[model samples]
Target chain A: MIEARGLTKRYGDLVAVNDVSFEVGSGEVVGFLGPNGAGKTTTMRILTGFVPATDGTAKIAGHDIFEDPLAARRAIGYLPETPPLYPEMDVAHYLTYVARLKDVPRGRRKGAVDRAMERCGLADVRRRVIGSLSKGYRQRVGLAQAIVHDPAVLILDEPTVGLDPIQIREIRGLIAGLADSQEGGTGHTVILSTHILAEVEAICRRVMLINAGRKVLDGPLAELTRDGQRLEDVFTRVTLSDQAEASAGGTAEAAEAAQ
Target chain B: MRHVGAIAGRELRSMFVSPVAYAILTLFAIVAGFFFLASVLGFDAQVAEAQQFRAFDYLRQLNLNDHVIAPFYGIMWIVLLFLVPGITMGLFASEKTNGTQELLMTSPITIWELVIGKFLAASLFVLLLVGMVGIFTGILFFFGDPELPKAASGLLGLTLVALSYVAVGSFASSVTRNQLIAFFLSLVLLLILWMLSIVADLGAGGGAIASDGLVSRSMRWLSSADRFEQMVRGLVDTKDLAYFGFMIGTFLILTKASIESVRWR
Candidate 1:
């Protein structure tokens, strides 16, 4: 399970994530939806312990992200806003290195590396240098590194951001399969952040909509968009309504001043 | 410790896999070898002439002792200045630039583990460089009488100097995502430290007023040149050892703190 309470991140005068709180239970796939600069990435960083919260707490698998970060980190796997990779390393070497660094038992290290490669469809390109790989293959290598240790929670930020349509579908399928597969199962709780609404509707059971650094909506995907409404319609309504209200309020102030 | 080893192994492998490592090794070999060969030839000529003269003049001509040793340290320092930055500039800079820092940061490892691991990896490369120098030093032994103690002390000094440089380089790399910036920063910081003793000497000579008189004195203590001089002279002063240890420790701690502060950003 992953839990966050009053999580906040501020950069100088800008509040990136303000008082955000949520939880995801085991066997849950939660989609984090937001427009550009909506603090989705910021929140994911905090949960993974990549960035610390300004004035709040986050726990992963019962371990506090700040108080016991290593423990919390041990329970989670993360792919950041951009997939982290060492371009000079070959695919097999990179995954094996990550597997060892993730503390896969020495005896199981080889097997873990192999499993991550096979699962990510990187077996064919195992010998290829990562610097020479295509974007899609690199993304898969990034995913392979994340799941090498098979942690209880997976936090992927824009996992499908730059992939071709076919690669996107394949990655989405991989995520879904990993979330449900028995051998790969840790009842793995996944928090996937993306702006692509269709992917969310297809992969996420629960959804959270964030706007301007705050959560504006949170619930199941189906219930959040009832009446057979498209996910995009609900998203537009939530975000655009805020923009329209601000504009209308500005106009009202101007009219009053003219009067 | 296992985590540190894991990171070190990966870093070491990456160093070998990339052309940068080979480039550094080749450059170091050429530069270090030329300097060593030149010094040995010069010393051998002087020794041959001294042998033809009286035994008393032989003692006077042995003044070349410092000259021969100075070149070894000089060339080693130059090689280290160029090569340490290459090994370390990309350690954290590439991680941040390429976004792998996020993955490593989120892993189940402490900041200390990361710092030490990276430092060790860079240090291992330095060790390899030092080892090659040792091979050339061995070749010197094949010629005329070589001062084994002085040679060993010089190697020791080189190792400590490399450790200090790697620590500072790692810290510099951690503060930025640009490898070029990291390299320049490390070089500039090292240059400042390298020149500190000269600046202090000038201050003491009234060339410039010491703004912070105590700082100038401490700067002398921090001088890599001063430490290496003592080490090359075969004096293993605990205080000098402590200074290098302190330098490496200070930078490693800075690296850890710098990485931790990113969490707040």
Candidate 2:
């Protein structure tokens, strides 16, 4: 339900996202893997309508990001790298506000917030201010917000960042459930970016990798690492091969361009 | 719109959730209370002197609008100039600093909905300050006569000026992620806005709709403080109303442009 065609984002001479293109069909969970400064966040931002692409287009559930930003955004539930939380707001109240912004029906807003909290395992801390919560709970709150409206598409940027191993497992399980659950006889379409290679194996169905703003690899998770080959070696081979070639040729764009 | 209301409601609640709201309210209350008492006491001293001199006719002619309410309203405006920046600096800048702006940016709401919602919340918070002035004005009627129309018009003028302050402040906040920069930027802009209008007030000789010349006409257009001055004179001309509407609209558009520019950046 996500289509990105030649999505390029340039900040002056720096091409943050260079003509990157990919598509994730409905009920597919795609893991977006990239190193630091690889433009993964920028690509996600462009798709979620947080920022405009410099020279391309993206559509979420058939709604163009540029032409119909409101409707396009209506189909998306985005969790940015930082989780976009208000420290002073309590968990339940904050979710209700987000539900309102997402245009969840007034009668069902309470139910939506409750369900989100329930799904994220955030019931006991509903009245606790976000600032007072532990890192795991804060991450859970972030996850709760993404599913609060039950949107058709979920674009999460490093959803498990800064969480403990147990918390990470919980979040991964939650995402896995989102991908396969028969909540409405269909699962949510999700594209999550992460630095952890194991994260993809744990939850994601497919894998899309980008390096220096370009998609270097996009394929099924199993096929990409078949024959007992580990995912890390494959990830390094695809991402670092370009760097090795650029450095050997003494090209100025070797690694600084991404930074 | 419902979207606007939802955003505005959160803004208001968030403000109260933080300490800034109570601190600014207490600050306005203490400062405004002192100004009110000072004006009333000064008016009492004048009345006592007039009675001592047996200037009965002059005492009869003396009105509360000129000696008490008008000056109090002017002081209220000055108080607003300082406190308004506090109210608006966090409107957008705090969202950026805390990274909560992403939530709003990715939502289904339009840019206008976000800007107008924060603007509405800021105006409502400042209205409570105006409401405090109402209580002081009420006390004036308790012991003496202050023209009702004049008082009402002055409050309206105060509200209009506040709307303009909030508009400018929101614009200032949208341009920066630092709350300190936002606060000082809007403070300077509000001060400049107030000063330029006072210049127009001086040029027009503080008269009602002084359009005798092109210079005065332009001066009237620049007159933010002058509009309040006219309203204090119990004048609610269309010119003053139009000027405020223009100020609020211009800054609202500017704020929206600044936000949209950030998305492009």
Candidate 3:
């Protein structure tokens, strides 16, 4: 469902996302693990068509992002690091607008919106203004937005980052449910980025670890943890390798540029 | 067009749902009303003086169109010039600051569609501002015998002026995430465009603008204020329309290009 070939991004002399590539098959949930400046969000942004790759190709369900961005983007449901939401807009109105932007048919919009809200557990706060909601509720709204159009692929960046423990668990269960066809949320190939190793352990079936813009590891989660080794020791053993130089600069630029 | 409508509706909803739409409308109406009242009082005083001195030449030529409507439209033109930047400053900048630009850009829409959608929303709001001018003119049709077409033409010109500023404001807003920066950038650009015609007429650039050399004529041709003044005189020249059309089209294209260039960076 997602294919990336030598995707790279550069700013001035800094290569924020180097020539890195990987592919995720349909309906597979992959965890993108990286440190503070591991180019995690940058890669996700490239895949979601939020940021253009400086070199090479990205395709969503066989549609090249650069060649036919709208089509490629249409198949994607993205939740950026910060939930892209309007503060003054209520939950239902905001979701409806996202539905329209994602090209849900006029007649089915209400149904799609209702299903997304129900899926995200946002029904209780449907009429509440987004700004007035707590962080967890806002995160759910962002998730609801991503799935509103029922896009085939979901690219979520740190969806559970700022939520409380219970909120995190709920969000994880929602994601896990989406990944499991038996849970009724079907056929969503998700690529979620996070620094939380336990998050990958909880929901993601595959692990793709990137460090300093290069993919250091990619494999089945079960195989990597087959020896009962803690994912933390493995992550530390790999990422703590000599590739940890000058990573902080990109984080600064990331916040500055995204703003 | 569907994409454009969706984006525009989102923008319009954001404006109206907050205090933004009401604030802009009420402020525009109050300021425009004061300008109308001032112009009416000035015209009445001028007419009374003319009649006292039996100045027939001045009186014969001095109708409401000349004394009241033209100056009223000019004041409205300047007022909108200041107000338009405020309306458009947050159109794109707020999206960036709030991170909504990420969602907007990632969605299935082209930059041209985004720009046009924003331009349409700003134009629609300015259309309401022009409607306020029409409401003020409603009182004129009652007691005064103003030339209907002439007054109507002035309002049309005001609308075009506001729209042209909208295009410029859209471009300005697209360039930055800071609302204050967007506001000042557009205000300065509009002021430059407003002053260009006066500067083009000085020194060796005198006589009719068309009779001048290419450089002087081009500056005059590019001067929106000059064309807007012509429209207020009840003259709807195709040249004026073409100038506004060309300017609006250019600025909107530039607005799209500015946003598109962000991906490259």
Deviating ranges (above 4 Å) for candidate 1 = A181-186, A245-259, B48-67, B207-216
Please state the CAPRI-style docking class of candidate 1. Answer: medium
Local distance difference test, per candidate? 0.86, 0.90, 0.90
Q: What are the C-alpha RMSDs, in order, of all predicted structures?
A: 2.8, 3.7, 5.1
Lowest lDDT block of 10, candidate 2 chain A: A249-258
Most accurate candidate by DockQ: 2
Expressed as tens digits, the lDDT of each residue in B130-240 for candidate 3 is: 998998887888978989998888888888888999999999999999999999999999998988777777734455554477867777778888777778889999988
* Residue-by-residue lDDT tens digits, candidate 2, A35-152: 9999999999999988899989988999999999999998998889898899999999999999999999999999999999998899999999999999889988998999999988
lDDT of 3 at B215: 66
DockQ of each: 0.76, 0.83, 0.73
- Quality class of the docking in candidate 3, CAPRI style: medium
Lowest-scoring 10 consecutive residues by lDDT in candidate 1 chain B?
B58-67
DockQ value for model 2: 0.83
- Write the number of the candidate with greater DockQ, choosing between 1 and 3: 1
* Interface RMSD score of each model: 1.3, 0.8, 1.0
- Name every residue pair that clashes in candidate 3: none
Worst 10 residues of 3 chain B by lDDT: B202-211
